[model samples]
Target: MQDPIDAVLIGAGQRGANDYGPYALRYPDRLRFVAVAEPIQERRTRFAHLHKIPLEEQYESWEDLLSTPQKARGALICTQDQMHVGPSVTALQRGYDVLLEKPIATTPEDCVQVIDTAAETGRQLHIGHVLRFTRHFQKLHQVLRSGILGEVINVDHRENVSFWHMVHSYVRGAWANQADSSPMILAKCCHDFDLLLWILDRKCKHLSSIGQLVHFRPENAPSGAPARCLDGCPISDTCPYFAPFVYLDLLPLWRDVADTSTGLVKFAAKTQLRAPGLVRAVSKVVPFLRQMSDYRGWPRSVLALEPTSDAILEALQNGPYGRCVYFCGNDVVDHQVVLMQFEGGMSVSLTMHGHSHLEGRSTRIEGTRASLNAFVGFRGSWIELNEHRSDRSFRYDTTGEVRGAHGGGDVELMTAFVKSLQDGSSQHSLTIARQALQSHLLAFAAEEARLGKRVVDMEEYSERYLS
Candidate 1:
C-alpha cells in the first residue's frame, strides 16, 4: 500500500470536517489529515483527535498554522465566503497547494487575486465546484461535447431553491445578510453559473439580471403571530415558515448551537441582558438550552454541534434560526433571473427561485441537431434527448450514479484531488482556479446587473475589475 498524502485543514467547520475531510477517513491509504486550525476549541480538538494529529500540528487560526513551516501537500480552505482569499494567498505563497471551498471569495477583486496568486506561485488550486464531478452533469457534458447535440444555441436553467432550505440557510442562518456573507447570486447560485459556463464551454459576452427580497419580510409576516414559533403563536401549526416546526421537523437532529440561552429573556431581547418585550414575553419562563450532544452527519458535524429537538427549539427561541423568517434581517433575494449572452451567439437564461416545493435544478438545452432537457433534484437527475425529425427520443436516468453527497460529486471531487496530489499532476483540469474565475465573474456581474437594473457588458466588467 502507498503512503497517504499529508493534508492540512484550515477550518474545522462544516465543509472541512464533514465534506472533504471524511474522504481521508474513508480511504486512509490515499490521504491523511496531518494538521488542523480552527478557532473553536471543541471543533479543533475533535478534528485533530479524529485524524490523530499531533498537538504541535494543531492551531487556533489559519494565520497561526501558516506561520509554521509548510508540513502538508495541500490545505483545505473551508472558511466562510469572505475568509477565502487571505488564507489561500498565504498557502500558495508558502508552497502548499489549496483545495478551496466555493465562491472563490466574497468579492470579485479578491477572487481574481486568489487566481492570480495560484498562477504566480505555480501551485495547484482547485475550487470546490463539486457539480462538475457528478455523473449526471458529467454525462451531460459528455453528450454536449460528443456533438450529439450539435451547435449548442441556447439554454434554459432553473434552480428551485426549496422553501425550507431558503429559510434554514439564507433567511434564518449565517447567510441571511449580503454584507455579512455574500450576495445571494455569489453564495447560492455561483454553482449554477459554473455549470452554465461548463456546459456551454463559451465565454460570457453580456449579462443582465433582476431579483429582490420580495418575501420573508416583516410586512409579510402572518398576522397575530409572535416573533418565535414556540411563543404561543396562533398560526404555528399552519405556517410552513414557522421556526420551531421547521427546525424541529426538517432539521431533525440539527440545531443552531449558537442560539443556546438559559433564559427565555435572552431569546426575546436583542441584547442578552435585556428583558423580554410583549412579543417575546412567553420565552421568559422557557429556557432554550442546547441539547444536541451528537455529531454524526452533515449539519450535525458541519456546524460542529449536535442535532436534537431541544437544540432546534432552543435555537429557534433564542438564536437567529428561531426568528420568524418573514421578520429576519435577510436581504438576499428569494427569486432571481440572470440572462447571459455567450460567445458564438449562444445564450443562457437562469432562474433561481426559493419558493419551490421541490429542490434541485432543471435545464433545457437547444441545439441545431437536437434538444436536451434534464431535471436534477433530491431524487436524482434524468436527461432526455430529442433529435430533429426523430421517430423516437431517449431518456437517461442517472439516479444510480448519483450516489454520494451533492449527488456523488463530493466523493468524485475529493478522489480526484487526492489522486492529483499523490501523482503531483498540476495539469489536471478539474476545477482549476483560473477556470473558476470565469464563473465567479459571471455571478458577480449578474448581481451587479440585478441590483443596478441594467445590462452589463462582460468585456467592460472584466477589463475594469478582473483585469
Candidate 2:
C-alpha cells in the first residue's frame, strides 16, 4: 500500500482475523496482511489464500514468520494460554513489536518477563485487554474519568461465565487444567484485575480471595451415571448436561454451514461448517462470535488423573459432576472470587461463577462515592454507572454492538495490536505482561484462600507463583 507493508497478524484466530477488518479490504492502500502464523494448518492456509499472501509468507509458527521476514515491525500473538510467553518474548527480541493476548501468562513471572523484555527491547507489547478498548467499558471509563462519578474508590465485578462455557473452557476444554493452562482466576479474571486497576488508576498493593470447583464434579454428577455421556451411558436421559451445548446442541450453530444454492458454488457463503477447525479460526478471526453466541449440552470427554488422592480430583472425575462414574472428565472449578487492594489506593472484589448464568456474564463496582455495573446475558447485556452526586446521577451501557471472543474482546484487542503497529507503538501501551502477572498471582492466592479458608498476603503470594 504505502510502503512494502505495515504489519502481520500472528494467531489468525478470532482476534487476529477480526482485527484485519475493513483495514485490510477497505484501506488496502493503508494496510495489508503481510503474513500469518497460525498453528492450525487448514486455518493458516485459508487465511493466507484469503489475504492473497503467497505461500512463502504463510507460516506454521510465529518463530518461522519473524525469523525469516527479518524486517517485520508489528506482530499479533494469539495462541492459547500456556503458549503466550515464548512467542511474545521471542518476537520482542526479534524486533517485531507485539500485541499479546491476555492473562498475559498463566503465572506472574512470565508476565514480568514479557513486560521486561518489551521495556528492554523498546517494542510495544499490547496485551489483549480488549474490553478497555470497547465502547462498553470505554464509555464507562470515560464516565469515570469525566469525574461524573467522582474519584473511584472501589469496584466489585463478577464475570458470570455460563454453565456450558464452564464445561468447555474450564472443565473439559483446552483450559480445564490449571497447571497446563492457567489458574481459573488468571484464565478467566485477568480482565477483572486489569479493569479494576484501570478504573481505579491505582496499583494493587495487597490482594487475596478464594475459589473452588463447587459444581461440575462427581459429587454433582447424577446418582446413576456412566463414564461418558455418549451412547450406552447408563443415564443420558435425565442428566441435564449430557450433550454439551457447545459440542452438540450448538453443533449446528457453531458448525452448521448454509447452502446458498446447494453445491460447491454456494459453499463459500458458509464454508466454516465444512472445515474441521474453521469455526475455531473464525472464533479467532471473525467479529461475529463476540457479537453472537451459544446453545446447550455439547458432550465433553473427561480425563481422570489417578495418581492424585486429592479426593477432590477423584470426585471431579467420577462423582456427580462427572455425570456417572463413567465420567465426563471435568476437572476445573465452577466458581471463584478474589479480593484486591491497589498500591494506588484502589481496591477490588471480584468473582467468576461459571454455572451461575446461561451466558458468561459480569457486573460490579461499588464505591464510597459511586458504583458501576456490567453484564452480558444469553440474549445480550449492558454496563451502567450511578454516581453519589448531590444533584444528579450519571450513567452508561454499550454492550450489544461489540462482538467476538470473550465478550468481543478478541476483535477489539486485535484491532489495538494492529493499529499500534501502524502507529509504530509498543506492547507496553496496551495491556502489559507485568500487570498480567500480578493478576495471575492474585489468582493463585485466591485459590489458596479458597482452599485454606483464610486471607492471603500479597508479598507472600508472589514467592509461590510466576507466569
Candidate 3:
C-alpha cells in the first residue's frame, strides 16, 4: 500500500466538506487532510472535527494559512469562483500542488493569470473537471477513439440543468447572478465544454451563441406572491419552485431516496425514517410517506438553522434561499446554445437548459461510418451505437451506483492526483490549468458572441483577450 498524501483544504464549505473531504474519511490510506482555512467558524470546526486535524492548524482564512509555512503536500481549493486565483497562486509559489474547483476563476484574464502563475511557479495545478473521470464518459471516449466511429464529423451535446435545480441554485441560491459569480455557461457548463474538447481533440475555430434570462424576473413573478415564500403572499400550493415546499418536502426525497442505492434507502428507512415525529407524521399520510420515505438531512441543512419548523421558517424568511424565484435579483440565463466550428471541418453544437424534467447530460456524436446516442444520468444511462454499412447495432448500459460525487469522478480524480504526486507523472492528470484555459476561453468567446450578436473568430478572440 502507498503512503497517504497529506492535503490541506482552503474552503470547508459544501464542496470542501461534503464532496472531497469525505474521500479522506473513506480512504484514509490514500489521502489525509491535515489543515483547513475557512472564514466560517462553525464550518471550520466541523471540517477539523471530521478530519481530526489539530486545533493549531485551523485558520480563519486562506491568508492566515499562507502566512504560516506550507504544511501539506497539496491543497484542495474549493473557494468561490472569483476567489480561486489568489490562494491558488500563493499555494503554488509556497510549494504545494493544488486541486482547484471548476471555472478556475470567473473571468478570462484571471484564468490566464492562474495558468501563468502555475507555470511560473512550476507547480502542478489541476482543475476539477471531474466528468473526464466518469466510467460512462470514459467508455464513450474509448469507443470514439477506437476508429469504430471513423472520421468524427459532428457532435451534439445537451446539458439539462433541471427546472428545480435551476430555480434552487441559479434563481434563489448561491449562484444567482452574473456580477456576483459568473455567466451561467462558465459557472455550470464549463465541464461540458471541457468534455467536448477532450473527446473531439480539436481546437474550436469559430463560436456563436444566444441566451437570456427570459423566465426569472419581476415581470414574471406570480401576482400577489410575496417576496419570500413564507411571507404569506399566496399561491404557495401552485408554485413548483416555492422555497418552503421544495426544501421541506422535495429536497429530502431528492437527497435521501431519489436515485440512491436500494440498500441506502433501506438503511435510511430503518434509522432515519424511524424517528418518532417522522413516523407519526408519515403514518397519517400514507401516499406522501410512500413518495418521500423520510430523508431529512439536506432539507434540514438548508431550511432549519435548528431542527424545527419555526427555525426553518425563520431561516427561509430571513435568508436569500427563501426569496421568491421570479422576484429575486438573479440575472443568469435559464437556457443557452453555443455553436462551434472546430479545426478539421468538424462542427459542434451545445445546448444548456435549466428547465427540464431531469438533471443530466445527453450527447450525440456522428462520424463517417458510425453514430452514437448516449444519456448520462443518475437513474439510468446507456449508449447506443449504429454502423451505417453493417446494419448492426450495439447498446451499452453505463449506469450503476456512482461511487462518489459527480458520478464517481471525485474519488477517481483524488486517486489520480495522489498517484501523480507520488509517482511524478502526468499521464492520468486531466484538465491541468493550460488545457482548462482553452475551454474557459471558448466560454468567454461564446458569451461575447452572444452579447455582441456576432460570430466570434477564435484566432482574433484569443489574440485580443486570452493572449
Candidate 4:
C-alpha cells in the first residue's frame, strides 16, 4: 500500500469539520490529518479530541501552526466565506499545496492575490469546487463534451438550498454577516459560477443581476424570539429557530464520547441515530438548552436578543414566511437572476432563488443543435435528468442514499485533491486563480449591472478594475 500523506487542516468550523473529520478517522492510511489551526479553542479542542490528534500538533491559531511546522505535506483551508484568501495565499507561498474551499475568496481582489502568489511560489492551489469531481456532474460533463448535447449554447441553473440549511449558513451560521464573510453573491453562488464555467467551457463576457433581503430579520423575529436557538424561548412554538431537535437530536453524534463498556457503538449501531460525541460538541456552540431545557427561562433568553431591525432580518427569523427566511436579514436578495454572455455568444442565465422546497441543483441547456434538462433533488437527490433533440427526449435518474448538499460532491472533491497531491499530477489545479477570480468578478459585474440597470461589459470591467 502507498504511504499516507500527512496533512494539516485550517479552520475547524462546519465546513472544515465536514471535510476533514471523516477523512481523518477512516482513511488514516491514504491521508493522515495530522494537525489543525483554529483560533477558537472551543472548536479546535473539540476537533482535536474527536480525531485523537496529538496535543503538540493542535494549535490555537494558524500562525502557531505555521510557526511550529512539522511534517505536513498539504493543507486544507476550510474557513468561512471570507477567510479563503489570506491563509491560502500564505500556505502556497510557503510551499504547501492547498485545498482551498470555494468562492476562491469573497472578492475579486482577494482572488487575484491568492492566484498571483500561486504562480510565484510554484505550489498548487486547488479550489474546492467539488461539483466538478462529483459522479453526477462528471457524467453530465462527459455527455456535454462528448458532442451528445451537440454544441451547448444556452443554460439555466437553480438551487433549492433548504430552509434549515439556509438559516444555518445565511441566518445564524457563519454566512450571516455578509460584510464580514462575503456578499450574498460570493457566499452562495461561487460554486455555480465556477461550475457553469467548467460545464460550458467558456468565459463570461457580460453579466447583470438583482436581488433583495426579502425575509428573516428583527421585524420577522417572533414576538418571543430568544437570544439563541437553545433553551427556553417564549416563542418555542411560535418561532422556527427555537427548536432544539436538529441540534439536540444529533447530540451523541456531535459530541459525548461513546461509553465502550456499555456497547455504545453497538447500541448506536442498532439505532444508527445519535452520535454522542458530536452532539456534545455541537451543543456547546448553543448550550442554552442545557441551561434551560424547559421553556420557563425562555422569556429571559428572549430578552437577551435585540429586536430584528432590517427588512432582511425580519424575513429570516419570524415573518409570514414560516422558517423560510428568503426575505430575511440585511439586503441579500432571496431570489436572484444573473444574465450572462459567455465567450462565443453562448449565453448563461442562472436564477439563484431561496427556493425552499427544492435543494441540490437544476440545470437546462439549449443550443441551435440540441437541448438538455437536468434535476438534482435537494433531499432525495439522485440527480435525474433528460436530453432533447429536434425529435427525441432521453431521461436518466439514480436513487441513492440520503446525502448532503452538492450531490455528494464533498467526497468527490477530497478524493481528487488527495490523488493529485499524492501523485504530483498537474491534471488538476486547472481552477486557476484567474479563472476563479473571473467568477467573483462576474458576481460583482452582475451587482453593478443590477444597481445601474444596464448591461455591463466584461472588457470594461477587466480593464478598469482588474487591470
Q: Which stretches of candidate 3 lie over 4 Å from their true place?
A: 251-312, 426-431, 465-467
lDDT of 3: 0.80
Which residue pairs does candidate 1 place in steric collision? 14-302, 253-307, 316-322
| Tens-digit per-residue lDDT, 1-467, candidate 4 | 77887788899876676545676676677777789888878678877887777888888877778666445779888887676777888787677888888778766677778877877777777887766666567667776787766667788887656554555556655566668677667767777787787777788888777776667656766555455543245655544343343232322221221221124333432233444344335446756323212221211222122222232234334432223232334455556788888888888888776646434577888766567777655322233334444466566553223233345676666766788888885434744545767777787777778778888988898777567
What order do candidates take by TM-score, descending?
A: 3, 1, 4, 2
Q: Write candidate 2's Cα lDDT for 1-467 as tens digits.
A: 33534567777754465444334664565456777888778678767776787877888887887777455677768787888888899988988777677767766566778888888988887776766766666666666676655556677677877565666567656677766787777777777776665666666666666667666666766665556554355556554455432333343333222311234323432444455355445655665432122111122222221212243244444444433322445556678777777675766778788765345446566666676777654323566666666534544446435543344554566555555566675545734556655556666667777778887777766765431
Model 3 Cα lDDT, one tens digit per residue, 1-467: 87899999999877888788888998899899999999989889989998999999999999999889989889999998878989998998899888999989988888888887777776788889888888888888888878898898999999988777788778987788888888989988888888888878789999899998899899988888888888885898778788776665554335333443345444444433346356446646655344344333443554432335566667777987788997888988999999999999898999998887767799999999999999876445679999999969999877544554567888888887888788854333433557788888889888989999999999998897655
lDDT, each prediction: 0.78, 0.61, 0.80, 0.63
Candidate 1 RMSD to the real structure = 9.4
TM-score between model 1 and native? 0.88
TM-score of each: 0.88, 0.74, 0.90, 0.76
TM-score of 2: 0.74
Highest lDDT scorer: 3
Q: Candidate 1, residue 168: CA error in Å?
A: 0.8
lDDT tens digits, residue span 272-343, model 1: 223223323443454342122222454333222765556655666677777777778788888999998999
